[model samples]
Target: MDPNAQPDRLSDLPDVLLVLIMSFLSFKERAQTNFLSKRWESLYLETRDLSFKESDFLTASVYANPIRWLKARADFVGYVRRLVDRIRDQPIETFGISISYPKPYLELIESLMAFAVQKRVKSLVLDFSNLVWRTYNDVNIEKLVVKIPQSVYDLTSLESLEVCACKDFDPSKLSKLGKLRSVSFGWMELTDLPPLLETSRLESLTMKECLVHDLEKISSVHLREVAIYNCDFYFMCIFNLPRVDIFKYRGDIMSFGFDQMNTIISEVELDFGAAEKKNDVSYDSYGIEAGMICEFLNNLLDEGRRTATTLTVCPFLLKVIPRSEHPHFLRPMKTKHLVLKTKLHPKEFNGIRLLLLTCPYLETLTIDLLPPSPIATASSYAGIDPQTYWMQNMSYWCLWEALTTVIVKNFVGGATELNIVKCMLRSVGERLERVELHMPFDLDESRKTFALAKSEMLQRSSMNVKVVVHNS
Candidate 1:
């Protein structure tokens, strides 16, 4: 080669650097790079991260055709087996497989999992959505649910594990994988989770749409974050989670207890969306345990505890907080960021008022305004006006010295919504710096009302307060 000739920078790169670049691409893309040059031919084999998705091998039309779908599934399974065979002796840093076919590919899946365990794969994700299939005549072509092989438990090097659409998952099986740190399960059925806490070094846990029965206690010393989204559980107790800093729960929580969560929790989000009506008949018979829920929140948000600095609450939860338990609601919280997901109903504004009164150090407020539900608009309490009620207790409305930012989303600028915005602007006073209103695109006569509200809010805001209104 001539000295003046331009050098092939990519080809001349170090082998380790090449392999690192290949790891970011999908397995198919990485294999395609083999034809680039003789040096690149064997380079893909050294790639440590392997990701396989059935959709990558089949087109949408192929998936709709039963014959083509079956053929694609067979080809995908064969490819996976051959790939695993090649990398069986090598170490894999990460491995992920997502199969949406409703077929019993258990043998093929298990083979890959066993190989990964043998190779000491650190991160593993298995997503099998819609795994059961039936023909138009109701004849079952495949009726399968994932049962994780026992070999996976022996992968002590495993750091992260995510399983979706698995059935009858047991945490006890993970006892041997002491190095497991982060774990997530979706659409699964679990009897208990205490075993995972007692055995593994789990730091983060997430459960989505999972049915948990007899989940009595979750006592984890190493857990840092737990997110339970749209999960159904019989009863649960948080006996000991000393290190948890971020906690989020959505859906119906019939009964729960927080016994030893005294450490500083940075963020707490709770959304009990029509929990009372959605709960089981036996659970609904008792109705919302307002006292228990409020007591737990009071302890979690107490000034002395100083745990939660950020809080997010949905309007439905206000229905669960009985008026009889007003003292529990009065406990001062140290929260600086408050997010309210509510339809600006007059009754719901009372809850917001209570929060404003308690969170004295609130700095940032975010409101997700939604349309009032039929149940709310038709309720007897709908006529109760928050402004008139607050006027009577004017002494409770004090200046929020620390509040600076306000973000209102889905702003239709209805009467109740405008009142809420005005209340926040007046309450925050000179310290408030910015207010962002995200208005809906499909505005009716409320568009003019929104402009008026915006003007009024600016007048009530601080001298330097910047108000921004944009179509959402």
Candidate 2:
């Protein structure tokens, strides 16, 4: 084998490896590879998965001269058609297309989908958002959807489908595909999706900046995880979940219809803010506006049956949850690993404690304390606790059992911080164990916060907790 010597044949690499490489490439690149040699002429067609992107075509179609674009359009269309014909009748496991309709690319996309459907391609992903995000105010998939071949439903292997940012898409045929497993959507109204998507086998679903109207009915037969963000959802709806592990949603006054879940899902993620709506959903008409943010939290505290193991509260999302008064458990997590990260002085510490009080099985806590954005004198702070800034609540609560391990990050030695630690230690009583405090502070503040913690903590013993000091 010599570096200067050419290989005897390109086919020596094996067809399986070529198909794998082709799957990672876009349609245009795959087309270009066909010109490399006779052996590669059909290599692109052999690939069971394909992703044709309109942006790639348009980006390359541009030239310094407009005259060249007009002259080249016909040749480009002819070349693409030939490529599609090459793959016709081939066994396709997945056939997907993404279009950024900057100008007018729908015709090309429609022809492509027709070819894929004729071959009974299984999975499909139509992403029309790249153009919408750049030019339009919103994304809906209606104007771009076409009359797809009904035979698409006949593909039993069809499992995952993602339709994002189209004009308006009617998901009517999803129910016919019994083998479908996962569905992802964005910037589309919630149609009768349950009727369309045979979601009985759905494992994971994700929606972003979308809308859910009447939540319909979701039974936890095989659902594993659900994530919805920046969505307008139905209010006062009872969700019966059985065997769901993760449920994530964001909107104001989100009611947990968790009374009917058959088995507990492992993780639950949410945003503590009202979902702004341009359309009516059951959740919005119930007066769960931004002002009544705590009402959303109150509902979670009362409705959630399964406690979460991993809890993440977005501080920005939480600020919208009216902290003028302490809120108890916007649904607490029995998740052993609790991660608290905040930029606003965590005014929700007590609220978190109240929420977790119901979690009978929590083990570890990790706290990340972010410094306040700017200085606020005593007057600007007003009603906030002057010493610990632990909201205005004068209440006694233990965040979790004393046996729980506590890790505090960004621990600065300040009078306020020291008081907060002292107060927390007092609550632990005889249960406190190892506390890892990453305290970086001035000599006096560091010593005082440490001393207060030592004196106030009557938990297991002073030796159980140790403070790691870093000079600021």
Candidate 3:
């Protein structure tokens, strides 16, 4: 060997380290290591993590020619079966299969699952959701009703299971997987999902873009975290989770209620996105009935007053406050940290004013201005004016007494944001310490201009307050 040549440190590593490194690669990539050397030929077999995605085998040309596609699918199945057979008695930690059309390959998939069960796999991920995008023109949709194999529910050794786009996966068929601690379901009908929450030992659950029809209640004692994003609900749902610590929800406002009112929660985030406009089409925003929105928020805040110390919400929550009917409608909040995802509109200011009156102990405040939405109808802007509303001398006890830190996100050096910042500074009671302005990525301003903006804010403060500007 040349003296200048590098040593083969990678090959010198122990077999356990090499197998562990190969475990992170896909099955095909791991198998390709067989060509490297005789010692590497069988090293891939000892890897306990197996991931086989059908897209790795099929190509664009195969898709264009049906015969080639069929042959490729057959070859992929045969190769996987042979590999699984070779490692039948080995202990597997995780097994994942991502196939496009599971309808025609149900038996093979089931056999693969059986192998995982026998090997005591700790995590299993079955992603048949790709079938939705791949079969738009190739296969009939009505005949593609794929369900999870019944063997999955019986896998007591499974600690985590994630199923995506299996359309007919009935939650009622879920048996008690005693060791299962985490589960995620995507793109399916979860009308019966409440049963799993009640029956399982799951500590974490996530659902995305699924249809929830008449999900009445979730009563869970073991569940600790839950995230529901972009899922459509038919009616109001009730939550009875006593031990849940972290909860997050996004999408259209859905009416909901909680059974345990006094239980303290760790954190909660509710984000109802701003409306959008595409071409000439107008997507309606914040369309829930006023009474329903009011009731929903009241219930949530009532719980938040006792349970949550940190809360994050969208401008829509502020826009719908029942100010006229009851001045003290909102219960006094104990929330110390508050995050407001807003648009800085006049109505949003009115709502913020109402909210500030209730949070007498707020320590930190964040105002994140969402990207501008399409112009709504004139009627939507009928009542409030941003300039006069924020400039008023009303007392915000939280800003005066307890507020120490403030963060403004998506700052554009606009008049609305500046005035809001001025208003907050004027109301500073003593505890207010630092204010940070996080500029947008596409801000059309120079460093000197940003420094001048920060200087202007500092000039508006009544006491010694630090103003920091971050231009992204």
Best model number under lDDT: 3
Q: What is candidate 1's local distance difference test score? A: 0.71
Model 2 lDDT per residue over 390-427, tens place: 43343345544533566665654444444455554565
| lDDT-better candidate, 1 vs 3 | 3
Off by over 4 Å in 1: 1-47, 53-91, 100-102, 131-144, 234-236, 274-292, 302-306, 319-330, 370-381, 384-396, 410-419, 437-463, 468-472
Query: TM-scores for all candidates?
Result: 0.72, 0.62, 0.71
Q: Write one digit per residue (lDDT tens) for candidate 3, span 1-472.
A: 7999999999999999999899877767887898999889788778889888887767777877889989988898888888888887778999988887777888887788778778778999887766435212333435545566677777778899888777577765554778889988776666677677888888888887677776877678888888887776778778777788888887665667877643666787876652221123322233333344455656765634555667787876676563434332556677778888887777676668766776778888888878782112112354566555567776645344778888888776666677677777778755678888877776555844864565465656555677887767
RMSD of 3: 6.4
Model 1 RMSD, rounded to 1 decimal: 7.1
- Note the Cα lDDT for every prediction shown: 0.71, 0.57, 0.72
Point out the higher-scoring one by lDDT: 1 or 2.
1
Name the lDDT value of residue 345 in candidate 3.
Answer: 71
Q: Per the 3 Å backbone cut-off, how many clashing residue pairs does candidate 3 have? A: 2
